[model samples]
Target: MNRCSFCNRSADDVDTLVAGAGVYICNDCVALSADIIKSKPAGPKRTTPVWEGVDDDALLAHLPRIDAIRHQVDDDLRSWVGEARRRGMSWDRIGEALGMRRQSAWERFS
Candidate 1:
């Protein structure tokens, strides 16, 4: 069975499976990707890749700070999402910002 290239969902789990050039995309990923593409605002998107260079010991030492920072980021995101909604942004647009489907974003944030 083929797995989705993006989310790694197996073909058996999805309602439909699509393949092209040795790559597979399941129905859920397709819908999410479509929403992301269609709802993208007109602008250049910037992505910063994470570097996995930290040693295990160092990572363990930083766990507390990492958890705190993660919580801070979550709180900031919620505040930003609320602000965006107040500014008349659609859930689709918010989902695009968070790299998820509108329904998923609504489920998480609303």
Candidate 2:
């Protein structure tokens, strides 16, 4: 049984759910959490002006760079996981390293 991230309720079929921050939230908790988080207002802060001068072409040109960066990050993460596994690291250890729970880590990679 997997424990719910929010309430720590034992649950089955947890592999089908999303885990966040050590919580294996059930579907109900997931919906409620989403609603609560969405309803919360952003704190007042210095508002930054939106840049209107940058055209679509410039943004489009950056897509490849962004994609490359994302790919590199993914590859790096995979490499790290491979190394960890090679060194006989436990799922709990990996999850702690990633700031998540062992179940969450397994859900993400397995």
Candidate 3:
């Protein structure tokens, strides 16, 4: 059995379910970590790369496109989960990979 690096919970695997880097957390720890990361402010310096000489108007015009792409990505993730389920992957494993509860994964995908 694999043990969670953050909480010592027994698991079948130690792959990074969410949040890359060397953090190997259990399903429960993954959910808590996601919540904490989302709640925190963006911090003083923006981590995203900014294009040199890009005007404010040009950046503003891309917001809608960015939102559309985000929605598409969410849809793709749901479809991927469904496909994974068809291939015999368990909901618990899927939930852990998504940093969510099993019920949450089902509800979100369904």
Predicted model with the maximum lDDT:
1
8-32 per-residue lDDT for model 1 (tens digits): 6567888997875445678898899
Span of ten consecutive residues with least summed lDDT in model 1: 64-73
Query: TM-score of predicted model 1?
Result: 0.47
Write one digit per residue (lDDT tens) for candidate 3, span 47-92.
Answer: 6676555788988876765555455456557768888999999888
Residue 19 in candidate 3, Cα distance off native in Å = 23
Clashes of each: 0, 2, 0
Mind giving the per-residue lDDT tens digits that candidate 2 earns over 1-110?
44554444446744345554333457777778899788878888536653365678986875665555455456557767878888999999999999999999888765
lDDT of 2 at 47: 67
lDDT for predicted candidate 1 compared with the true structure:
0.75
- CA RMSD of all predictions: 19.2, 16.7, 14.0
Model 2 clash pairs are 5-23, 5-24
State residue 11's C-alpha deviation in candidate 2, in Å: 47
- Give the residue spans of candidate 1 off by over 4 A: 1-58
